[model samples]
Target: MAFGRRRFLAVLSTTAAVLGLASPSAERAAAATVCPLALSVSAQVSPPGGSPYTVCSGVVPSFDGTPLDVDVSLPQDSSGPLPLMVMLNGWGHDKTDFESTTPAGNGANTYHWNNAWFTGKGFAVLNFTSRGFHRSCGKDPATGYTYATDPACAGRADWTHLADRRWEVHDTQFLAGLLVDAGVAAPDKVVTTGDSYGGGQSWLLALSQDKVMTPDGTSVPWTSPKGVPLHLAAAVPQYAWTDLAQALIDNGRGSDGLSGAPGDGPHEDPVGVAKESYLDGLYALGTEYGQYAADDPTADIPGWHARITAGEPYGKDPLINQIVRQLADYRSPYDMPVPPASVRIPVLSIQGTTDPLFPAVHTAQMVNRLQAAAPGYPVWTFYGDLGHSYADNPHQVWAAANDEANDWLDAVLAGSQPTTARTTLSTTACMPGQTNATLTADRFSRLANGSWTFTGSTGAVTTSSIPDGTEAAAVDPIANSGCRTTPAQSDRGVASWVFDPPSPGIITGSPVVHVTATPQGADAELAARLFDIDPASGTQTLITRSVYRVTGSPGNVQPLAFELWPAGWQLQSGHRLRLELTQSDAPTWRPDNETSSLTLSPPVLTVPVRTS
Candidate 1:
């Protein structure tokens, strides 16, 4: 049954009273009669053995008049002004990602749960095709994905701004406002969420509080067309990035040291090493499944990919530095202003410990900032083995992560304290029948009670050959981007060290590595990998890893300190801890390509450990 504006509102009011639910006020009902944007109801779908819900799909003009295809699903059995859940899609994906019933792989499918599932929970879910993707005034001829020509988007080719707060983020706020004005969503009870790309957007929305940037770059309070104020009650950003620049191309600069904790130094002026595999994969997906702004330097996917992968003179190139600065300033939540305590939205951030694209450290950094800026704000983080990479226990972790997020959302909406811990870290169990255990703490740093350090030194290693191992292949951005294990191999151009723990323990935080190195060339790059080596068979399970890039005068010795991606790994008694440093971790990170060598003094490895 197709319900027009008046019929929908009438049904809502009548059903609400019949069901003894709160009915919309007469003022709200009257205001619903006049919607600012023209909305057309296409179909009313009823899931098998479930209540019917209306699905409305149409083009909505964004901040700059860019037409965005939006889908709104509302439960027919529910009353008006229901809690709103604005679901977003990942990069190169469309609104259908959340609407479709197909399960997303990689143990990160919670965000892909269909719209009906949420509407069944009394949530008015809104999904939209982000700017520059299919149905959002862009077309990919290869995939035959094209939308009906809308005059408003006549000259708007390749308009994706890469989730710029002023663009894609504003689009979501604008659409939510319309729903509020139409009495379809509760103005104060809205939540934003999504995975990967959408996760990043959700984070920015939470940081935005109730403010939005106008098309002209002016910041203003978020309000509906009818003047109803809008605010996000909560945000769940799964496997998201706080800093797009650091995520895609990372400089080793980590968060400022947590009080009394050893942290990486301040952000120095340096262009980071590009994650070639992910960058290539994303660029291809954008061009194939969506649209890319090839000519627009700021939004040009191809240009950015080429410049990043070109390699060398990294910190010296002004254009590359400009690109990094622009990405961080325009696309990173790290640069956004934290909301004051009065308006700070509760955030439940779920990240993957082994996700090479955006690791647990990303969320940890954001959490630290939030804690410092808005003390005691309701921000919880859950890290597991999931996301764009492979997981050792996909089903178990996926279910657990989803449960945590759901409970968090429920608690925040009910204005009750969440029973869940402030931080939860789940380790990837590598052995058969091994329990994938969890560790909880009040803060990220507190996850590890103490640490174990191994001191060592190695001969000169050169970036002449690709590292040999399954770990490298498994973590490759394109080939086998997931967690995997194989027999540990000590090969040429690889610096290796092994440590035998006297007792069973858990490595629970980011591993810090400090090396004094003398470069053979103008620049040097290193990929560090930590593994769990089976005592008997020597089988190795990849725990976590990171890539570091640096430029210096040849033969000049400099102290290099960096942290690997944060992880939670249980080490059995008698099992060994192995650390390997190589020149290239191909397909995961772009190889430095130059035949440069590094002469390093004894390196120090500090691992945060907890023994119960």
Candidate 2:
């Protein structure tokens, strides 16, 4: 039932085995051994029950000689040869995991939705699993998580490196070429898409200019698992990260509107928050020169990049830090080292507003670079108020149209016109009782607050367990890192909003807080936190928290301001919705230091709820 290069794995192996080609002396010796495996391809049914798709699975070469299992799904009813696509997964994940979760629910993979939307109109999808993260076999011999997790082998990682995006870009190019060789797909029509790690891979594939070197000595090139030049056509990454190095640096200390809470008071441990606080500077570079050379060692201000030179920093870093530098350069379809003066294909992208990993600056910078390289690349950005996760976010909005986001792929990739809206929405907090049982059990608890009091299925879902080390890093507002812990004053002095326990379980998404303050022009800060607001110990232990800042400047007269961000967690049955309004958050935002005293009114942070 499968078509495309993925099928070639089966066809070639079968032919080889049938002809006794397993080994030159197999027939003259013992016996040819073939591993028994089940590989099948399927599709989404529309209008309650639509056409079934044909798909196939097989173990193929990943970034290395070691094989990776892939499931290539295609439309059975297409009238012509199909377009090609390679889908990837994120961190601590595998291929099947991608198939199970997405921005869209219903067990339909969002990437799969791309397949459905495009395949039904005539496109082909090849889902790839890299070496270590998922079921994909093999290993990353070089940098990134691999090096840190296995440092002794750090410098040795060459073609096997999965930390940099080139390894993945090669994975897509090789897989696409194989599909073309099989005659099931057109090599030139292949496109790539993914989220988080996958999404970052998407951009890496798109901007991959060539096999370049870095000052740090990391390696990247269009090579086979054996080091060969690979190719591609288009790409789309969602909620991705770029300039993570800069992010680590700037997030260390915040500036003006941008802040990264490193840790708590001077005595606080920098362990979890240290390197990450520098994202502000990283994002600043992304905002200012994301399209340029922030990571390039040759750049004037190599620490962070902004504007113009940001359009493409291809060759600059190849001579210095190869690992960190190589992480910056990726080869696109054009076979060039930069995004190219133009792209032969259109590109589409999505980003979450409250994504904890990367900044919105990355998305904005990407569009600028794409436009500079090629006019009308046909880009799309979807905003969500969630952190790095794709599965569940308390801030997720239930959009009837968001469910149909794949239609864009259908229209552009397979040539189908899907009628769906592509806009951002706020999470809708669940009411006291209803059918869609707001409580999503597993993913419900780990958010703004460290944990929530729950009932019913106490242990039905594992993700519902508490995340250790949950405390806001203390911030020195003066030093300008806006990240901080919830002050006792904020609990009693600031305006507070509360909700009662629900009879039925509940799940909350991103929150939108609206606050009214007296004495206009106040620097109002709204923080949506999930805590035992009425703490049994009298002191509320802070959990995961979301904070935002706004300068009230409406006609020099401040009205109620609405600040939206992700609660990105769940509100268990007994947990209540807590919204606090105050002058500042320690390190994440600027403190309101105005002489005018501000009072909080109508301070309620709305929770997003979806019921059955």
Candidate 3:
């Protein structure tokens, strides 16, 4: 299996050669023509019956005169007059992050083929990079490149190359337009979807048909694609940053939750908005051209210390330093807020359970804004275990999520009337037959062959019991009875179960503890939290949340089972993952009894494992 270097660089340089298509003006002439993508397609099946399909690369003209590379894939069928789904990539990225193009040899992006099922279900899938990304013709000789000084980055228009701004948006809008231009899809009814940054764009396209405000707050097109629409027929946006201002706020360094100094008030001022560290680095590099050697200076750049601590050698680059500070002040929600009432189309919003950026909370914020603005309309939301883009991003969910979003869109695009349920979760959909992935209390995560761990509990413990082949050094959280010993305790609410780290490199799914307190009596619920020893502080980053709330009861010997969300935390090198148990996660979740001493048996912690 060779890495895709030719397709990457080839498309990066020459587009017409790869996609076998003409330039923009030429495309316009061919637009109304019915040259509906003369292409071949196929599929590759994963073990146990999971099949993904793909298509050869296609072409279009994105950007002003630059060539844009297109990767279109479909299901394993030659369905006719298929519904189309055209998607674009995010910053510093291309179509690969979404889906692969080919399974064997050097092929196209998969998202094209990944959507084959969607295509099989009757839809044509499309994904591509703008002229700036590989094979997409546009290139900014300044900021994006290491040796170029991007002067454009220093003004009101945001110094991104025209490729970044116009070309990318053009990439998506153009694809959808091409279908109609070439008579592939009807303009009025399109079901578009994406997660994270791409989700932002899908919302943009659904709205692209709407006549609304431009990025500059000026009103534009209502349907014919002017500066992106403010509407769509059915749009699914998952784990997306609701507002740019909130994104900068959530992305601010440190978990203190201050967004900015309290004086930073509203996000009306872009310059005074926000600034992340990288933004500053770009400025410094741009200001001090020919002064240093580096690729992109990300946060982990080792050379930063050598340059910064080496005295004020780079002191004259304060303007460069202000780049980060400037970015922090940005408040462009919906990429550029158009008022949710402005968004009259059906919307399906999904969120990730543990996405650090563009978190579930951000999605909630969007719902709040939209509901307040437009009281009666269709909106569906889902929170799942997946993260950002399924394939293309370092932090996005690609496959598991794409299907989830697509499944819902399938219902909407089919014109199913939705109930007025403000929030609809996906627990019932694809709910794998609940598998009991249990491990003895002494072990970290569950492994095959009944090997929970090498230790077990010595007495009455709440974690897991000292079962066969359990750890010898298993910890007992029951002994840790006081709140003072718990950093997360508020009024006697904290539970801890300790275990050894699994053989290094083993990442475990969320842990579910099935415990039975012989006597069940509680008004409060049990909040399950996953924590690990904080190497330095010797505590834990207690990832706590509610499992279920049980009404305080007065009974004897009742079975109680709590399923904590399957988590993905590592019992890292030199550290162990701990399960903190509590009647409730305080302040946020209040436990009724502080002194309810009940014997806990069946002390089993069920952990999901990538590699047992």
Judging by TM-score against the true structure, name the best candidate: 1
lDDT by residue (1-612, candidate 3, tens digit) is 001012232231132324333345434433332234453222221211233333436455442333445766544334434577665444444554444323221222233223434544556667665333333432323334421332322212222231221324444555665555554555655566554456666555554435433333354454333332222467776455555433432211111111111111232221111222322333343333211223423221224333332322122355324323323222223443434554567776656544433435455445545554565546656554434311112112334344445555666667776532334322111111212122222111222222233222535443221122211112221112111123322222234556775653323323445555543433223445555554545644433232333333544544444433323333445655566555433222222322343445534665544444
The best-first sequence of candidates by lDDT reads 1, 3, 2
lDDT (tens digit, per residue) of candidate 2 on 264-367: 11111110121223333333422221122223333323442222123212223433233333334442121223354433344555554434445444554445
Residue runs of model 2 more than 4 Å from their true location after superposition = 1-48, 62-64, 77-80, 100-121, 138-160, 209-233, 246-326, 329-341, 368-377, 386-404, 414-612
Error of 2 at 385 (Å): 3.6
Candidate 3 TM-score to native: 0.48
Give the Cα-based TM-score of candidate 2 against the true structure: 0.48
Each prediction's Cα lDDT score? 0.73, 0.39, 0.40
How well does model 1 score by local distance difference test? 0.73
Determine the C-alpha RMSD for candidate 3 after optimal superposition of all C-alphas.
15.7
Worst 10 residues of 1 by lDDT: 1-10
Writing each residue's lDDT as its tens digit, candidate 1 over 1-612 gives 000000111222233345443324423433343322575554455444344566666888875678888878777646778999998988877775566321222234553345756777788889888888877866746456564454667665437788888888988998899888777899999899887889999998988868888756688999987788887999998789998888887766765233333564443346667788778777776765566665776666667778888877675577686677668777888877877777888999988887778878889888888787777978999888777755433677777877777887788899999988999888876564345798888888887878887887455444443456545665554345444677766655578888776678888878888887777865667778888888677687778888777677887888888888888788887788788887777777777756777776667888888888
lDDT of 3 at 509: 29
